[model samples]
Target: KNKYALQLDLVKDLEEAEARLAEVEQKLDPVGDYVEASMIAAASAQFHNVVAQLRILNPNVEFVEDGLDEDKE
Candidate 1:
């Protein structure tokens, strides 16, 4: 009987711990999403900035699709 009671108490504690972990994860999900979004936004801005710098450095360069043909090379 004592063993069964101890086991029940342990099970209850485990359940409470799991519930708390779940709540904490739920709270952190939005923060994770915001960080991910921020990284993506920063990367996009950097890419555009690089493109702009490249254009300034080579204003006369024409952008052609598929680039130079291998046969022409």
Candidate 2:
């Protein structure tokens, strides 16, 4: 029981760490359309990779899509 509790605590810590990292990343580089578009794109790609890894680690998770317009499609 103690071991299970410790494991849950560790998982919570990891989740918090990931959220903090993401927040820092966003603060450091505010998203916009400018010369830094390439940098933003790279950062976004890296962020997606990290998120994918997290999804794999946590099986009971679903990723949501953004900007889905039926007319555009």
Best by TM-score: 1
2 Cα displacement, candidate 1 (Å): 57
lDDT string for model 1 (1-73, tens) is 6999999999999999999987887798845787677777787677667767888898998654353222231
For each candidate, give its TM-score against the true structure: 0.45, 0.41
Q: In order, what lDDT does every prediction score? A: 0.75, 0.75
Across 2-46, the per-residue lDDT of candidate 2 in tens digits comes to: 999999999999999999987877877667445377766677787
Worst 10 residues of 2 by lDDT: 64-73
Clash total of candidate 1: 0
Which residue ranges in model 2 land beyond 4 Å of their true spot? Answer: 32-73
In candidate 1, the residue pairs with backbone N, CA or C atoms under 3 Å apart (3 or more residues apart, or in different chains) clash, namely: none
